[model samples]
Target chain A: MEDVEAQTHLIGDSGEDPIISKIALAEVQRAIDSLPQEQREVLALVCGEDLTYREAAEVLNVPIGTVMSRLARARRRLVEMTAAA
Target chain B: MSELHLTDEILMAFADGELDQPVAAAVARVMAQDPAVARKIVEFQQSRRLTRSVFANNLAPDVPSELRAAISAKIEAYEAAVEGGEGKQAKETKSIWGGGMSPVRMALAASLAAVAVSAAYFIGQHSQSEVGRLAQLEHPRVLQELSRLESGRDAELPFGRLRVISTYRLPDNSLCREFRLQSTSTSTDAVACRTDGWRVTFALSDPAKGAEYVPSSGGDLLESYLDNLGAGNPLEGEAEAKALSETAR
Candidate 1:
């Protein structure tokens, strides 16, 4: 039971800053929160799987240019929000 | 260096590894040396990692037995409805899922319908001078095919062409469509649809995989094409039959 409980709550033994993790989590949430559904999806797919622009474009059924445009827009929003915070 | 105004999309794409090697390399050089852009990139990456961790556990959680049972029941009901022989009309009515449709299956049904309706007539219509005149008749056809495929299960429909290998509907109303292009490794397939056409979307392909799904924009734009045709409220009688007539060929 003790071993099982420890395993369940484990965040790994790395002593890295929880503060950075917290910041990252907050930033990601914020970036995605205000985004239109399509932008949020683009962020999720591009970021989540690390796909290339062409790949993302094909999967999303948009032109590569559109994919680039959306990513650019999404990134700008994140930067602005982070700056505001 | 001219201020290097990094757009959010470029920075995100860079962070997400979406840029091509040459372009990506160029961006990398800029990011490494450019303080403002680098800082922006890190923030987004951090967010991605955090959000993923937050919901990663949900991916593995056992779908509630009741929810699973409900889905199973829906599937059985759908099958029974199909077997009843209402044909294409019945399929569309049964498959036209709005709030009631499963998100995962909705995209498959919707995309299948979209692809079928949009592809058949529209493929030849483009680059033709008569494109504008044909648009009026084409829109209804897409909707009708969706209904027919959804309700009637037409033998001539292209739903059978594309193979839907897997599907999943998140607790949230996001429908995922995963398919392999018919008879071609060169083509890859995926689409995500929302409650209304307002939110219909697709995934990005794998860059290394090349143009896996080189989709021709069918007759209508895949995302916006379904705008008028919400689930359940399919075109009726002749309108529905006329729409599906092209696919029967």
Candidate 2:
């Protein structure tokens, strides 16, 4: 997560002031890291690698519906985390 | 459907590009009418971007030397097994490398495969002409050429060969055509539909993997996109001919 804080300085285009964007990005990274391992894995595979849900299911060895449910839960959790932040 | 009626699953699918066309369009229409739904969609997209950024920050600068050695040894073993007619061993080795590996390791391996494919295609091959044409997707001439091919024109351009792979009508009753462009160095698969003119909905390019490159019609991304759009089986033979004739008008 320290690496995330360091890298956030380079993330632009958020329309917020540069310092504010970096802080927001760092907070989001912390929120993601706090997720359960399974949720984090699903989120990483789909969002990070650009895999479709079916492809992510194949990789995670789960059913497609499971992938959808996990992803939905993971996303919902992130929204809640960010809103609280 | 009302914006208030939209479910989390549906909104997530739309953000992830999982919804079919009509459903996606309906979502879009609702978003236009509902600020809350639109804001949620934006939040979903931002979350995805943030998640990806975090992972991107974590990527190792280099592959571990031991992993490289393992890959090389595996390849050598695969070759030896092939020579010895031990097909089972080769299959076992592939499974061990592909299925048994960690997700990050698997992604690294996939990138290596893509690099190999790209290297094979780009070496000593002239790609400018083909790549240039593909980059001109919005040009009037390119659209005209696409339209001609969709309507059964079989003329070859200097860039390479072009042919329609499939044609389908969207829920809006608009006609779309999936086509392939094969050149010496690269191959592209694209979908364009007749709106005010031909508008490209999707396009993917790969280095020439063999003597010819034919993108699988059921490629994961394309399949997901088609599923979201509620696209049906591609028109073929007489159906394709009929769709082409209709588009001509």
Candidate 3:
């Protein structure tokens, strides 16, 4: 699990209530689980594993451009899903 | 120029630190005037953080027991092969030594062999001058560092620090260890699999160029190599530890 302090820092929010943070975490988890397997894998490697695009490409055996496109699509989907929720 | 059109690819690349400076600067300038684009970028960043938080566990999953067993078997097989080869070679050499020679002649022969071995070692080191200085080190150093990592000890060489990322058996059943070497300005990823000893099958380096150049992560390349070799999934934390411990023993 990610450090709550780091997550707050990334989102640039300090005054967020603990209750709201918990709800947001649940929403984010649900949105991610809803992603297709390929997109989820891309997101996991690029964001979670912290790999460079070139590195992700090499790992997945796809082109770097493909990794970029998949990541873009994945992020867009997550944003849309979270907003809908 | 027409209104700056920022494609999702460009925006994502900018957010991910994958874009070169001038292009990223242009994107930033455009986003300054467009709230929609700026919001999209923010969304991407937020999603990245969320995804990272959610999937952080994937990187260090528990190793399956079957994989651990496979590794142990592979190590035993490699050791057997090495012993068999050495036994045959030693027998031939022993016969040669036993074939009677005067004591003085035997002493002279031993001296010549020593000089020849030293000359060969120096020549081998010299031949690797075109490679990085770290790559020129004796093979024993690599084995020693690998052993240290197996035993959960810190190992460092003159050129850089070594990190054993993963260990697995290749499709051909060769035991392989993937490691990363981080130096002051360069990072090298290499895969060394056992034959007679650990032989480097793949190595790639990313030397620092300028302030903007980020070192490419070695894990991806190592994973890709494993994929191509049809090496199954990497041994997880416990499996890796068990395999390393067994090999060390």
Top-TM-score candidate index: 2
Identify the CAPRI category of the predicted complex in candidate 3. Answer: incorrect
**What is the C-alpha local distance difference test score of each model?**
0.39, 0.54, 0.53
Which runs in model 1 stand beyond 4 Å of their true positions? A1-20, A23-27, A79-85, B1-8, B54-249
User: TM-scores, in order shown?
Assistant: 0.33, 0.43, 0.41
After superposition, the stretches of candidate 3 with alpha carbons farther than 4 Å from their true spots are: B1-4, B57-249
Residues A1-85 of candidate 2: C-alpha lDDT, one tens digit per residue? 2234433322222122456546656676777667776676677667665566776676666898888888888878776776666
Q: What lDDT tens digits, residue by residue, belong to model 3 across residues B95-201? A: 11112311111110112111111111112222243144335322577676664475233468776677777778665566677777667866666666665556555
lDDT of 1 by residue, A1-85 (tens): 1111121111111233455444544554566667776665555444433334665565566898887777667656765664465
Query: Each candidate's root-mean-square deviation in Å?
Result: 21.9, 12.7, 26.2
Clash count, predicted structure 3: 0
Query: Going through the candidates in order, what fraction of the true interface contacts does each contain?
Result: 0.20, 0.38, 0.46
Which residue pairs does candidate 3 place in steric collision? none
RMSD of 2: 12.7
Instruction: State the displacement of the C-alpha of residue A78, model 1, in Å, after optimal TM-score superposition.
Output: 3.7
Query: DockQ of candidates 1 onward, in order?
Result: 0.10, 0.19, 0.18
Model 2 chain A: which ten-residue window has the lowest total lDDT? Answer: A7-16
Candidate 2's error at B97, in angstroms? 23
